[model samples]
Target: MSFTFFTPGPAQLYPTFEKHLQTFVSEQLGSISHRSQQYRDLHKFTVDQLRTLLNVPDSHAILFLGSASEAWERILFSCVELESFHLVNGSFSKKFYDCSNALNKYAHLFEKPMGESFVASEIVVPEYAELICTTHNETSSGVQMPVAEIHKLKQRNPGKFIAVDMVSSAPYPELDYSLIDTAFFSVQKAFGLPAGLGVWIVSEKCLQKAESIRNQYSIGAHNDLPTLWKNALNNETPATPNVMGIYLLGKIAEDFNKIGVQTLRKETEHKASLIYKFIEKQPGFSTFVKEKANRSQTVVVTNTEMPSADIIKHIKAKGMVVGSGYGKYKATQLRIANFPATSVEDVEKLIHELGSL
Candidate 1:
């Protein structure tokens, strides 16, 4: 039987995916060389669409890389010369901190328990730390950092750079680009394309940081920030580009643009509310996030009193696929993605099925 995917990131295909694929083959997008004008046009179109749709400023340079995971290394190697600070809460945030350590950078952390968040006023940044990394939404725990709090941290630490992992929450938070120096996400998450492409948006300050360190150490061969900045000036990449992915991203973004980001965000909230409300009223289930304010609109995770396998089994029997909890919580929690690609009708159906159980 066929299944509807509610698994987060690599979750649901954007409703137009099959159509995008047909266009990819019919237009021979895969046959075009990266250096060709056809490929260049595709690159420029995708960049322009993302910038306009996401409200990115002219001061930011948009670059495409492998995955959001790779962007973590790029941010550390390119932007941080010595020390960095992290606000860790869940698996993804902890990974970002681990990435800093893996690179031999002096990484300091102000960690909260799995479901808690950083208090902006209480945050203390180390004097010599060059970058402060934050996860806008932790997909593993379904907890989100408020954008206003991020702005507050920037206000408090004007001299240091703020890097955000918006992996599963981008194009929805309506971030004020002026407040963040760097942000990154992979298409397989919110954008709903097949995996293998990441989008990194960096501001002028971040570019300067990379340029200053370029002469000293090799950040990355094909994806060094300075090289990426230089190529993005012409809407290109240093490596052979993911032409089809870029083309598909452009087409899917165009559809999102036509519908408007505000509308999609509202729809996401509406759909997420249905599930949260269900959990509140249902027995043997509660949100992984203790505070309602900490809940993520894009990825909703619930703690089941019993093993989540029965829920998964019941949902799967109805031809809908749901994700198990991340890492150690695998047997106890369920993760449901509420992305632009997941329809409100589908969410309601899933809620009804979940309620029936």
Candidate 2:
């Protein structure tokens, strides 16, 4: 039996996803070569739709990659030569810092407890650090770093390149692209598409940085920033990409555009408010992120008084699926995705089921 999915990434598919996928398969769009004009047109359409939906500036180039995880490595490799700084609050943010360390860069972090948020005024970037990384929404902890805080951070450190990991909160954070040097998100999350495609948004300055340091280090060969940017100008990729995923993303974005992003954002907030308000009154359950201001609107995480597995099992039996906690909190938390694909009705049903328990 098919069940409604509220799992964060790989969550419920968009409402019209099946219809679009059927059209894609029947047309054999996937058979087109990446270099073919057909594929280029598709590529340009997806990038343009995303740019319009997300308000990405012309100065920022949109490049498709393997996944958001890959984008992390690309950002570190292409932008930072020696030093980088990160704000670490949860698993995803910590992993970005780990990527920097694995790349042998001098990565420094201002870390906090899992559910805590960062304040821009308190953050101090090292003088020699060339890049600053922040996760717009911490999926694991359901904590979000406010866009204003990110802008403030940029204001304070005018010279540092700011890279945002919007993996689970894309198309939701109304980020002023000018304030950030780079940002990325995978389609599997907010876009409600199957996993595999990652969209990386990089500023002109970041591309120039890659060019400046190309001769100094092994910044990557094929999927490097310079290479990706060069091909993106022609609406193409350096290697074969997930053509099906790209097409579906464009169609879904077009759907989002028709509905208006502001309307979607407002609806997302309405659904999130229902979930958060339910958590407030639900006995034996509490929000993972204590501060209301820092909670994620896209992924709502809650601490359960009972074993989360039992709660998950109980909910699953009723034909809806939610995510268990990430990492160590696996048995004690519930992660409910409040993505654009999940409607107010879906959330209401999930809440009704939770209320019954």
Q: State TM-scores per candidate.
A: 0.98, 0.99
Point out the worst 10-residue segment of candidate 2 by lDDT: 213-222
Cα lDDT, model 1, residue 46: 90
Give lDDT tens digits, candidate 2, residues 1-357: 889999998988998999999999998997989998989999999998999999999999999998989999999999999999999999999999999999899999999999999989999999999999999999999999999999999999989999999999989999998888899999999899999999999999998999999898879875999989999889998989889989999999999999999999999999999999999999978999988889999999999998999999999999999999999999999999999988888899999999999
Which residue runs of candidate 2 sit more than 4 Å off their true CA positions? none
lDDT of each: 0.90, 0.93
**Model 1: lDDT to the true structure:** 0.90
